[model samples]
Target: MHLDQLNQQYGLPELSFGDRQRGFPVIKIKNRFATAEISLYGGQVLSFQPSNTQADLLFLSDRSHYRPGKAIRGGIPICWPWFGADPDGLGRANHGFARDRLWTVRHTETLANGATRVILSLQDDEETHKIWDYAFELAIAVTVGETLDLELTSHNRDQRPMTITQALHTYFTIGDIQRVKVLGLAGLDYIDKADQEKLKQQIGEVTIQGEVDRIYQNTAPKLFIDDLSLERKIEVCNRNSTTTIVWNPGMEKTATMGDLSPDAYQRFLCVETANAAAETITLAPGERYTLGITYRLL
Candidate 1:
């Protein structure tokens, strides 16, 4: 767990470790272009802000508890095996267990491009086997630079095939949730999670009038978060991902969520890259699947 030797070997101050409440390890990376905080508890990225930026691009709730087994309220949460609820009518935790388990840090280095790269791995244990009954290997690789790159790979080690749905649930800091417009989901049919999972078509760019939760399928690989209030746009480039989810708790639900800050709902929006709903992924023995997304400001 010591990085001093690795740091001296790499010739840079690459990684520093600290405890996030209750003695859980958190890794901090200071690269040439940006700095980030990653929690090994769930391989969750808690913060990422580039150089010379006043505010972070990712929104992390100040009210979030840094306890074990509870997922943080913001940032990039890795949702795997299942997205929203139990897929087979069994009562399991919402959004699976990957975000709750501690992951092993496999590699950390400064890349040739001067970017910081960190790799983490997690495998099924007795607890996970009791819940999901699947043997698999999951790895998350994140590259920090002017732009953020997150890639998640899942490999099946079992003799049988299994299906799973996942998402890189990302919370982005916005100037105002009421004024931000989500582009690139227009003209696509989506499953509206807010309206009893009704099928609907997005007539134009998305506007959040109330609480919204929709899953758009077969979407374009590129999306944009045009923040009119901030006068900045976030370009999102994705690969090997079929579904996109847009969510906001709005005024009412935000009051009910205990983990969110008092004004958290008004300052951030979630535009997740997903393989969920009907677009589930099936992996055979020895097969691997990767889902990746990159975010940058323009």
Candidate 2:
């Protein structure tokens, strides 16, 4: 299906509940330079564009095949405060409250550069505080320009300090996961999720296989995703985030995702620039921290 048709069928006029829970809203923002649609529910980027071309879909949503009750099939799923399953973590869910809450559209302003930025903010509410006690605020400003810019800020308002791990958790669309190569994480120390204590030294390009999940530590500022099928390079540049997560659930795990097609594993790969593992950020009372990832098409 075309991007616009997908939006017309699923896009929201205002905030509304999605599959998983109650009180979430789907928000859409657009301007002359680009059109971006996102749901405050999962903070999922439904569609992004640079000039009229579709930039990213993040996931593949297939209602016909459902696994988890309300989870959508495709589009990026925002993993914040924690990346994957954190059974020992404070919250009951795998990821934190950032993606599940309804975010208010704070403002949308046109920049001097002729680009438009849509700012969305979500604060911890009664429902959130019940699970996680931190009084926090999250602001995400999506700047639509020649390339897409995502600025994420987390503010701690409580009297005590809090430490948390976060990630933009992007599922970049590709021609084939096997044909794609990720660059810029060489010679770094990473804990192979397949084996926790065994730190594998990253020496060359990244290749995905059997339940791959690793946190690349003290990484450089830039990473590249070369998609051979699309004949395009996605340059991912990070600001404020120190760690990068490269993951794909592979064949067996892909079956667990209800919204994903059995063949979905072949079409996408996640090269998430994150602040997880040992890089958990500590926010003092009233202090705020920011992390950004910019996607430039080459």
TM-score of each: 0.95, 0.84
lDDT tens readout by residue for model 2, 191-284: 8886765788997788766677888999889999888877888899999987998888788987887667877888888788788888888999
- Tens digits of per-residue lDDT for model 1, 183-212: 999999999988999999999899888899
Report lDDT (CA) for all predictions.
0.88, 0.71
Model number with the top TM-score = 1
Query: Candidate 1: deviation at residue 157, Å?
Result: 0.7
Error of 2 at 120 (Å): 1.1
Task: Please report how far candidate 2 places residue 226 from its true position, in Å.
Answer: 0.5
Local distance difference test, candidate 2: 0.71
TM-score of 1: 0.95
Q: Where is model 2 poorest over a 10-residue stretch in terms of lDDT? A: 13-22
User: Candidate 1 clashing pairs?
Assistant: none
